[model samples]
Target: MNELTPDVFDALIGQDFVVTNDDGAKITMSLTAVSRFETGAPATDIDGNPLRAVGFQLTLRGPAQPLLATQAYPVDIPGIGVHHLLMSAFEAGRTAVNYDIVFA
Candidate 1:
């Protein structure tokens, strides 16, 4: 569960996602979040078929609450500047789960 660098996440950035800075405030990406993104296609087994990897799409949801809530919201963090942004496959609900995003 290692933290990914901006370069790594930048590779995944495209036209499907957005990232904003907390007003240029420093922040760290949660390990759990990173882990989810790092999972990718598995190696080929003896069966001769490549293992299927978990697929996922990442959407930047913001206006984060002071505490965790059970519902989901689409908002931006007020006063935050542009830190980093990313978007995966826009074709339907497909996104690469093999990349992690790291922000500062």
Candidate 2:
């Protein structure tokens, strides 16, 4: 699998990703937004070299029904391989629920 970066997902906004529920059912979620930021602190590599602290967040919208519990789920991103991403439901409306995946 390729490294997941903000740029990698930036172009994928508005695309649908399939999440396999615990019951073996597929739930479709649309990639609503991608937020990117930089941490104030500098990061260091394994070799102790300084690196920039960058991170990103992905917001996905799915149906309100079958509200998924906060946990890691297998999400299939088209063109990209399937990845187990930690998702948390942050908002809900009458018809849709929003999930967030943060990478830092």
TM-score for each predicted model, relative to the true structure: 0.20, 0.88
Off-target runs (Cα >4 Å) in candidate 1 are: 1-22, 33-54, 57-83, 86-104
Best candidate, lDDT-wise? 2
Tell me the deviation in Å of residue 66 in model 1. Answer: 6.7
Query: What C-alpha lDDT do the candidate models reach, one value each?
Result: 0.32, 0.91
**In candidate 2, what are the lDDT values of residues 1-104, reduced to their tens digit?**
33788888998999999999999999999999999888665578688976558878999999998999999999999799799999999999999999999887
Worst 10 residues of 1 by lDDT: 87-96
| lDDT of candidate 1 at residue 14, scale 0 to 100 | 38
- Candidate 2 regions off by >4 Å? 45-52
lDDT of 1 by residue, 9-100 (tens): 43544323333233543322211222234345566558876543433333332223222223232222223324333422112222222223
